[model samples]
Target: MTRRAAIEGKPVGSDAYVALEARYGHFTAMQVRDRRTRGLDLHLERLESANLELFGVALDRAAVLGSIRAVLGDDVRDASVRVYVVESGGRPLVMATAAPPFHLSGRPQSVKPVVYQRYLPHIKQAAGFPQAHLIRQVARDGFDEALLTTEDGVISEGAITNLGGFAGGRLIWPDAPMLRGITMGLLQRMDVPQERRPLKVAALPELDQVFLCNSRGVVPVSRVGDVELRQDGELMARVIGFYDAIAGDPLD
Candidate 1:
């Protein structure tokens, strides 16, 4: 699959990849279809908030959008895009990358809980070494994704997505600190019966269903640790229905 990379809105050469290592920084991921995206405003707001919190300056929304368009170019209209505020030697730089479109597999996920929490959980940190490490460790142990939790087993979120549960025909998101994902935000805006509160690994058995959400989309979880989740197909189908009904916002 073809991929493109750029820094400060200009294409990066093969040799430039090495230099970008030091420029790695915070970012927000999104999927674009026909130059349109779901929750584009929320994605931009995430970048803006992260930029301010990490660099003490507001994100250049126009410049970032232009960079995304520039990197995507005319030929590439549908793809997975990531907008990064690269912290180089001097001032931060805007980097954008376009890759093959991605989507969550409808298959239920199996997650393994780990006693770990990301630093500054609100922002999507560029370096998620701990999360990545735990994911790898759990994968070796036969889990699909790592579920982040406190030392005492308080469920916070998934390594790369927001975690939630459904029971009694209502949804509930963990109250613990985690990135406010764009996809999750969009669902919250719609007419849905949901609430947030501290969730624990032990509570998984109580909920009729579990799910994870990110830019790629939402999917149900089949298992967390040794506990197999109940198959709440109707609830999940309704969620996907609501999500699919959300029209993409035009990038232009």
Candidate 2:
């Protein structure tokens, strides 16, 4: 496979492959390939908006799959997106949307991108079914994703996206299982201190709004854990407007 040395300031190809070693601590053949595939240039200018008050842009699956095809020279199909978007000081932030590991070492692998596995170790004391298994069950129950918080009471991210819950005049996050997303990262930088601790499912009623984020789905918080999330129409409109404005407009 053709490998790039680097992209903008981000790691790619072989460097990306190697970094997952340090991030995940051990090299499974499946993880190595997924890491490489996950590496792409995050061009915010191409996806940001006017006033620089950032909105989000959709991730083009075809484009990503095409790149993977170019690199691996193999049949690439069935890629799913995991969104992660953030806005900081009014600028849209884009970050990782990792695909599950694919075994290129000839094992006829079946991939299950389990969001629970990423944060399970951090919440071992929580009384619940295995997070990964629960996620699969949720999928079976007709939900698209799952959010796993730590024992400290902070909402983090989902099976495929980051969590944004509004309550008590602030946004909260548990700070485990996922990357501090580009959008969420920017929010934190702009004085939106994401509460990084353990969160509980029982706290849902207190949350006035809930939404998932990623660079692609730059949408607003609409629901949580089966409860109908409060809709901030103004917030949703602003986000949509921002997305529409930046998506096709010329950036300075």
Candidate 3:
């Protein structure tokens, strides 16, 4: 919690820090609890695939994990961990950092729809200014978050979380192009009854429940613009129960 960070094996202010300002890179965020993480393999695969796509090279998973463990040390029990791979000097520089754990408010979020879509929606790249801008704009407008949509009014996802809904005893994910969240993928692997289909802003009121999910956790959406969503407690409990059952992979 002392604002510690490192690049490669050097501290942040060293000459190697130039990689942080690189124009192209991809990163993954995860919660490290007791030196272990959930969906650790999925996180590694995401980094490997993105590195290959951007740098034409496969990321070294062991090296990446080593960097993470090096920075985390043995003292930090719970922390927010981020691993970044930046293309610099025609090569990829992998850096990992760990900080104090992030805790969400746990209160239901109120979101407002915004007309926007991410470029290369599947990759979790560092170019997030547009999405960050939308989130700030909506926050100023008295909303907790922004629900991104395409020009045709089809919901793509939230500014930071994957959007999904409960309808007729199934989990309905927006079929539009967006980043495939690790948490979302885990839920699918757990065999949660789910379907992917295009969701429109105008149909918000028709859904039985609305929720947002990311690496942190799943949260209910109490309101989408002016439409109030029914917070089905039983459904949310089941979803959380599924997430809770997943075991974390050891960092060692």
Candidate 4:
């Protein structure tokens, strides 16, 4: 399907696109299924919080939702939606767009650990140069994605997803600094025993199972560097069940 996108309530080129090119911005990706999305409130909260921190302005929740609804119209149901709050001309401009859906690959994902960390690990910003560079380098070395870590060899998160794993019959997330993904938050709310502690890259082989969670979904990790991990079907089923049970909020 041809992807559809808009900026500031008009086509991409209708306005001075200089601001859109700016790296000083924050965005949130949502899986819009049937014009609804899970954790819609959380997404709005993220945008609001980032806007205040990055641009010293409050984001309008109603206006942002309105823009998303208007851009999606009444027909497009399932889409990959991204809302960008960029600083341009000393003002904050909100741009909402929808593209084709990107579902999770149920197959195991291979990742290589990289010694890197984000600048503002808390807020989800548009600073993609560092991570992108790392990802490109790792891809060329025969890895599906890059797992970011600290210089001390502590696993933090993936280039684009949050890292979690099953250890000793519990879900364990890294204790290091990283963006708290909405999907991870939802999974934690499911009453699962979760732990946030420093995880060493050398200890990955000892974990029962590992996965990557993001807006797309929970994806199993088969290999981290050269060490292979267990690909448990039971764990994948439970994760999928937890996410599938989440009720989506309507855009309208």
lDDT of each: 0.84, 0.39, 0.82, 0.83
Instruction: Return the TM-score for candidate 3, rounded to 2 decimals.
Output: 0.93
Candidate 1: lDDT of 242? Answer: 90
**lDDT tens digits by residue: candidate 2, 26-89:** 1001112322312132332222221132233454334333333333333323232222233334
List, residue by residue over 1-252, the lDDT tens digit for candidate 4: 345556666545323334473457888888988889999878988899999999888997766887688668778888998888877678888777777888876778899999888989878886577778888999999998899987778998999899888988899999988988889888888777888999988888888889898999888899988988887789878888989899999887
| Model 4: CA > 4 A from native | 8-21
TM-score of each: 0.94, 0.43, 0.93, 0.93
Residue 159 CA displacement from its true place in model 3, Å: 1.0
Encode model 1's per-residue lDDT on 48-145: one tens digit a residue: 88898889888888778887887788788899988888788777778787889996678789999988878888988776677778889999999888
Better of 2 and 4 by lDDT: 4
Cα deviation of 182 in candidate 3 (Å)?
0.8
Model 3's alpha-carbon lDDT is 0.82
Q: Candidate 1: which pairs clash?
A: none
lDDT of 3 by residue, 109-187 (tens): 9999999888888899866788788989999989988999988789998888998888888889899899998998888
| Model 4 error, position 61 (Å) | 0.8
Error of 4 at 196 (Å): 0.6
Question: Clashing residue pairs in candidate 4, if any?
Answer: none
Deviation of model 3 at 58, angstroms = 0.8
Q: Per-candidate RMSD vs. true structure?
A: 1.6, 13.9, 1.9, 2.0
- Summed over model 1, clashes come to 0
lDDT of 1: 0.84
Cα error, residue 209 of model 2, in Å, equals 1.5
